[model samples]
Target: MKMRFLAHFVALILFPCWFVSVRAEEIKSPQPCDFKALFNFGDSNSDTGCMASAFYPEILPYGETFFHEPVGRASDGRLIIDFIAQHLGFPFLSAYIDSIGTSYRHGANFAAGSSTIMRQNRTVFQGGTPFTFEIQVAQFNQFKNRTAKFFNQEKENSFTKDIPRPEDYAKAIYTFDIGQNDIAAVISQSGMEYSHAVISEIVDNFTSQVQYLHELGARTFWIHNTGPIGCLPVAMPVHNAKNQSLVAGYLDLNGCVNYQNDMAREFNKKLKNTVVKLRSHYPDASLIYVDMFSAKYELISNANKEGFVDPSKICCGYHENGHHVYCSNRAIINGKEIVPGSCDDPSKYISWDGVHYTEAANYWIANRIVNGSFSDPPLSIAQSCHA
Candidate 1:
């Protein structure tokens, strides 16, 4: 009986992996299309080369897994933004601080790691300049400015005198992935009441930001849904209790934190509905909402069931209370020079630190997006190449 039970358990474990691999193999690769450039906005999950350099050198350890050094990513390696750009056959968009002579003929990255949808959310998240959605619009204007100069230089050399208008100079693929920080910061800084208010109030602010971008000639939009917040390790200590953690509120029939998980669901539902309404609001706008929430849950929930050993704990964190303290300094621990600890193979783990995913996890989510699994009505970026 015991041997048969073990055999059944092993088969159950192996089946999901085989299933996911087969599904991955079945996905059609992206074909090159008509988008001249790609522009990214929002927080760290999509930030490729904007956050780490602008903030702190200690950010190195965070990207050590895949990048080997700080490449201005929030995770330990490539982010979803990089994957999307690569899928489109464009070079990784240069950071504003990089001063590299890259072809902006495509677009530029305006994403900053701790950015928010609302300007006020910055103060709530602690340090750094508030690269609000409004500011991202301004950065797009700068990109348009640079593209105009490139065209004007070409015109100066030719006989043609037709100047490209701002609209003509702008041909882009725009992505917005903000708002989680705004929701998170509300709880981190203000009371829960403020968090609830932010949940309701930011809908209009988000709509306005999208509308503003549309007015600026941004037509191809990839709006990402909010990622799972209750699952983050940082929240573990914050929501800890004697009997259980707030994360317990997301469990299925297993006495887990279903209620907390539902909070994330509620947020995604509203955002999804808003996307539907926004599509109706602007007939010319081709806005696609990407549901990262469900996909993130797919990777995170039962992480142990998916080959990760430690789901509740971070790779590097304070051992006492399960809190994250910067593990930057290579100090002596019991006479050995140690920077505390880091995950052996970050690719195997879904999370890098307490709050974010490993590069491999980001790749998985991007693969899901590219495969049209994350999109409503399944609109792949490859399909929008003609847009």
Candidate 2:
């Protein structure tokens, strides 16, 4: 009788505390900045591991700096997208193609290296077929459908609770960092004379993709403009070689190929205008244009000031005669396997493999991009998340 009385006394004391805790939770409301997921699409600039997952025999020297091993990322370390995820308190996005023990609770990365905005069979530098932006969008739709069905099945089976609602996907942040490969392909195939026409076509395709994504419940958009491709070590040698007579006049004082930079600027202008149009059309949505050109140009123009000793020189490459040898883990040179050499300090260099930026450079650019100045709508990504 004494034991039962003691148990009743304890229950009476704890019951009110438990009820109050439950009531407090029930009264709490979700905050504006309480983002639940992130969805990304682009090329190598933001590809976490989509390329690696699609192709086997993962390349080395790609993720050596940050991950300590290759994880299919084009750079030596994390990309700007990775930094964004970290800033938002989320783990790195899992590549959609990664089928082995992957989680979709946070989000998926559909970005692939050498991916183009246009729907074409354009081959990447590594000879792998790219999954274009159109395909990525389709894949996202499929993912959504599959996830919804899974949630429904779980509900019917009484196996799980707290399934994501439709609004959750609509509220998720959608980021795009494509179009570099499209311009590069045009320049490589038909010279800079045809870039303006190609840029128009790319913009049309890009805007259409945004509309399609909006229809699929994406309300927030973060679009990245193409960076200065002409200043790349690989492109500089090619530009100088092709325009030998015009090199002296066209090259910048900093020795970067200026004509190519001019093309990039023109493309960025069009892209910015497109963003304005998108905002006008989708008044309810948050469409932000990230100024990648200015962010990158600042680094290039003030390399010394930014603590980078060599902004023009690539961190990893093979030394050759008046040409920048592309960085690769394994390459055949006269039937001999050759490995590219890397600098002792990659942080002091802007370009990593003649095309992609080093981790340090990406970090710097990401900081600028998220600090509100580089965004067109005059709001940082963090603020947009809150909005």
Candidate 3:
């Protein structure tokens, strides 16, 4: 009887120690999951409706696939940013320009279609005025100031009211998907010879913009690099002659123009290096570089595996010779109103409107981004937001 009691006592003594160790480990590996907001900045890739609100004003065929009506998205469906917001358990972010009745409690999107990193007056494909990176940052600063004052007023009016604290800004995620338009502008206006210098300027401007945000109390950044522009149906027709002779030898296995993809790769490399430097410079910040190129490339390379019938062809665009002839909302043909057409099966096509990805492709990429293995430092959107 005495020996039995002693054995029980020994186990009791060790059990407390074991439990304490396990709990300490859990405490050390704190998985944060209470992110309250998401602030986004970028170009058409992430623009929900800023451009549409400003210029197009809910044009048809823009958001026909997903929203069933035009909601300002550049694609036939949702953009990658929309999926990210949905994955993070937040409603679609409202554009800063269209925040009249919207709640900013979950943050706002300052991105616009054709926005460039540099502070230049650039027109996007449809001649829409772009809100450059500088302009976006300025808008963000304005938002912060305005929100802070409003919160302060609310707190003063009612101490019992649950108001968002200033520290919440630090916990919010700031995402960027700009720089593509900048590269595209350079390629179209200045040719490939000046691309290196333009890309350098782009990186420098991007770094500066990040620094500005960091100064404004943003600690978490999710920056996306430029994607394969040359592969887009819009780009293929424009740059085909530049490398027509080498097309047979240089095109990707998926049939995308290699020269444009090469340019995208170079930009990604430099952006990656720039992100590394930013990490070192701001050791306390969570600066993540999202590899959008690889994500899109994977979808293109494994289209069949992903249940996509055509990765290169656009789901909604002008048709010519059994291929996409670029995307446009309307074209005047013989004085009649002819609109851009859509494929019967968008779910089976990767490209949407020749430039953006279909809703299916965006969902897949967003799933990969938030589920892990697509971001640098290897953190998913869920983990990043929660952290």
Q: What digit string (tens of lDDT, one per residue) describes model 3 on residues 276-311?
A: 999889878888888988887887788899899856
Model 2 vs truth, CA RMSD: 12.5
- The candidate with the higher lDDT, 2 or 3, is 2
Give the alpha carbon lDDT tens digit for every residue of 149-252 in model 1.
74555445332232234444235678878877766765555445565565666666788878878877888788888887767766654324445434433455
Q: Using lDDT, give the best candidate's number.
A: 2
What TM-score would each prediction reach against the true structure?
0.78, 0.83, 0.84
TM-score of 1: 0.78
Candidates in order have lDDT scores of 0.68, 0.79, 0.77
Which residue pairs show backbone clashes in model 3?
Answer: 32-386
| lDDT head-to-head 1 vs 2, winner | 2
For model 2, the stretches where C-alpha displacement exceeds 4 angstroms are: 1-32, 121-128, 154-165, 190-194, 238-246, 322-325, 330-337, 385-387
Q: For residues 1-387, write the lDDT of model 2, one tens digit per residue.
A: 999999878876879788678889996643445667889999989998887888763566778899988887888899999999998887888899887767667778999988888877533222334598989999999888867776555344332222335557887889999888777766566445656777787788888888999999888888899988877877665423553555356677666777777767877888889889888898888888888988888889899999997676778876444544566655666686667767898989898888899999999999988867888766778667532
Which portions of model 3 miss their true places by more than 4 Å? 1-30, 121-128, 154-165, 189-192, 237-248, 321-328, 332-337, 385-387
